[model samples]
Target: MTYRVFSRATVLGTAALLMLGHLPQAHADNAEDLITRGRYIADASDCSACHTVKGGRPFAGGMAFKLPTGSIYSSNITPDPAHGIGGWSEAEFSRAVREGTRQNGASLYPAMPFPSYARMSDSDIHALYAYFMKGVQPVAEAPPASDIPWPLSMRWPMSLWRAAFAPSVPSAQKDVTRPFPDPAIARGAYLVEGPGHCGACHSPRGVALQEKALSGSGGPLFLSGGAPIDGFVPTSLRQDQRTGLASWSEDDIVAFLSTGRNRKGEAFGGMTDAISHGTQHLSQEDLHAMARYLLSLDPGHPTATAWHYDPAAAAALQRGDTTAQGAKLYVDHCAACHRTDGRGYAPAFPPLAGNPVVMSDKPDSLVHVVQSGAALPGMAKAPSAFVMPAYGRMLSTQQIADVVTFIRGAWGNNASPVDAATVAGLEKSAPRPVLQDKPAPLN
Candidate 1:
């Protein structure tokens, strides 16, 4: 064999050519990976909860949000060039997501929760863009224009609101992947503060309708509980024993997020949508991390005592005592499902005793659930869809009020009693449920 003396330059040149030959495949693989990551981010963000309606094409966007001023519909986020975001460049998409700016430099309404999304890392945003632009199927349908009246309907004020209330736009190249000392906590924080946007519904809003706190840095007000939205009030996510998750273990939190129910309670209202479209699909690791971070939070009200189960109400009911204001009504209607002890069948009918949502100082959710009832969304782990029948048609307003008051005060529950006036107000404002030809399956 003849030994060939090759120059180092020649060897390096050949190596470069070989590397270049594989570059296309590498690029393609990277793009696919980014798109995959983006899909996960979208799910974590619960984008579909706002963008898609029941039985509608995913991300086609026709869901209407009824605001105090008027109703505003979500815009199509699919890749259709004409009616969706297909025409948007990555920069345009970034601006819209991070800065609340639209394709035409107009500002997006806060209904999009850009204030929370503004904290998302650039890498995450890039991945989200990749998925929306490449992975998602395009839809040509455009949602109807917002019914918000003029002045409020105008987009200009949105820019001002964003500037004043929203977090500053994150640096384009910055990756805020680790803001906490613990890796798991950091991951959870990112998910909650950025894409998860839990504060949008859970945190109270100021006079300007901006969330009081964006993160834990905003103090106890963060995730402390919010005003009613669509009849149901978002319960506190903090550590308060009475009205928050102080009773929930990390495992319980994980179970609730993944399956929409746990030993403590079952999801209803917007939370059902969140579980069905968003959290149920998340990896166990992510769910655990979220649970861990949530558990780490300090109680919103440090002085609040842990809830203890008292059987006084149960004892009274067992003795056939109908003297209590709403005792007869509860025994007549709710006892079969929720039981006399106020402890319902586990993972089926949620236990009312020591339940955080029930004990919440704000009785909006309790009243709403009593009036409108709620449907549990089915998921992979839990497929049986359970619905609490609406009593609006069956029970008079006073009867409903009395029953709610009894539940709230029963079983050692520390919640304030709701009166007929409060119940009447919620009933009047509550959305009229669409009458179905066939009754929903209770199981």
Candidate 2:
């Protein structure tokens, strides 16, 4: 038989037809891929942080959110037909995730972070649904009902809030796309804005109490930071040299995520939970991607005076001076772990000199740590776990303020001085758990 010659267009057309003929199989393969991706997305989102109770089955729910008005327990999300979302269709799940509406037409509190989830792509949502439905084990346990009081408990107002604050999701058929200069940056943006929901804590809030910026580009406030969570202020993720991550390299961010501690300091408070559950499990590539994206953000605001080593404070500290209450306090209480030089034992007590945590403008994280103390989240990669002893009972408000001021100002940290009134207000807002006579052993 004589071979028939074909034009390039004709050959391409035939190849397209062949691909279309295998569309069903391709679609099935895509579904599997989506399920796999969904698992990663779920981990990145730290769904377990809110949905799963401590020592409980994953995604079975029961975690209680202690809000301003009252406590709200997370709903069971396992694929149990009776107690979970097993019966939910993809549409229903998407609505709940993106619109903050329950299958029963009830409004979900902003605590769910659906406003950020609204930015999620349809493919990602589909993937998440597939993962939840097919991959997760089913549990029949029902979540406890919310304990929010009268008017606040009502769901109707949330609809109004949703309408006012929530970003609109494109139709499922329409693809939502964000253009980034690099593919890695785009991936990082997705993780931060969609699933990670970093802005829910890092971004400032508007008058209506909604997050001021949903995504990094929404404004300077996006990750410029000033938001408060559980009495701790989430520090700025911006590139500001003094208050933000300007000094951190991409590796520093990756190290912190992987081990919950970097050269700068260890994560505490809400960040501990995020690292222990969410980011620690992420692939090195993903962590790097997130770091790359974060590094690209503009600095929130440049400080008038850059931080430099304080010779005067060093001299005073060296002189055995008990004149400044702060210096005396540091010597008596902090010197053992933090050391007289402020260079704490790495991978343990974290350094104070040039540390971002110490230099942050808000001082909330520092105050919270001093007042409540914190148990470092256990991570597989970390060498050991430690607990900071709570000083709320031992230290007077002025003493706490004084010590905080000393650290912030003494070690090349140029943040504003903290006052006793500020310390007292935080103490009242969020009281620490009672400390036992004997300290718990660091594992």
Candidate 3:
């Protein structure tokens, strides 16, 4: 009887040991999955756009931000024990990301976009922490210090700004129990409002330069239209007939996000960075969801007439009519690439006719493009690069204005005329053309 009892006890002990071994493996797998999710979140948030320096290590943080006040540099976020967030706990990291507060209690500049990140879910925060801690390569590089001036540069004032403009932490946290009217819309909302932070560029700003609309529900200004970034205006995401995406179907948006081009135009300037780093890697489902949410916005305008081809202008141009200086300028300077009809070579030279950039009320983009020229973002799908040569040296201010005016007014694009003064102003402020760099890897 004693021998039999000893054998049973040994078997039970072995089974318990086996279960204990399996538990650790299960936990490790779960942890890996969380890290994977966190990687996705980081991509969606476009953390690399600011954090990573061009031609430098990813997330090692030497990117320069030229604000109206002064230039500031991004911070290193690698898991390096000395330089990165290797020493940070999950709570410290979360506070830094969500509350814009560093572990040492210094306030972060709004350029970090913690205002939008504050809305992220706790689960996502945990997952992000896991990815940063475990999956990322540790880099021991420190970024350059910011160049912001005193009084304004003081971090304490930002705390007061946060108290007034930023949302409370408890309210912003995502609740799984909360039901969205549609799952796609819910996902899109999460992306745009939190990770995507579309409003950071697209939405109009108040006196304090705070985004007037944080989300779609905030007001019509949410993605309706706003200021220009790096010379390219963020066109209205709303459904306006002229300046917005009313003519574009949901598929068009998805296509644009994925490949950086559709019937309208290709991505250039700041948008190129966004597409290259953030949107291109997103799944088709997420792209569609984003399209759906953007389409749902009420732009406070009824759909009017769709822009169509007018043969009259084309015929007149063919006849060599120099009656309109703008028309004369276009035929002389622009027609070869843009074509006589303003319908440019597709997926290469973008068409100006019926294009949102041409139709925008503000001529900043058109003026800047004409002055400084532009290089379309090179993509894997579209391997060949296309460049719009700078006319700043060749063309006079009035001539530049005239050519843009012709494009804007031609082919049923009834945007307001751009004057030489506007062109002059843009020429003074426009960024100098730089040698185009190869597209950076999304990883």
Task: Give the candidate number with the greatest TM-score.
Answer: 1
Error (Å) of candidate 1 at residue 268 is 0.5
- Report the candidate with higher lDDT, 1 versus 2: 1
Candidate 1 positional error at 56, Å: 1.4
lDDT of 1 by residue, 1-443 (tens): 99999899999999999999999999999999999999999999999999998778989999998887898899999999999999999999988998889999998888898888888877888999999999999999999888888877888988889878987775311334435658898778778777899999999999999999888767899899898888888988989888999989999999999989999999988898898889988999999989888887888899999889999999988988879989999998899989999999979889999998888887878878777877785688887777787788789999998999999999999678888998888887785553443424432
Where does candidate 2 stray beyond 4 Å? 1-35, 171-176, 303-305, 434-443
Best by lDDT: 1
Q: Residue-wise lDDT of candidate 3 within 41-149, one digit each (tens)?
A: 8888888788887688889998888988888888999999888999999999999999999889899888888878888988989999999999899999988888888
lDDT value for model 2: 0.83
TM-score of each: 0.93, 0.87, 0.92
Could you tell me the TM-score of candidate 1?
A: 0.93
Model 1 weakest lDDT span, ten residues long = 434-443
To one decimal, what is the Cα RMSD in angstroms of model 2 from the true structure?
5.7
Candidate 3's displacement at residue 292, Å, is 0.9
Between which residue pairs do clashes occur in model 1?
Answer: none
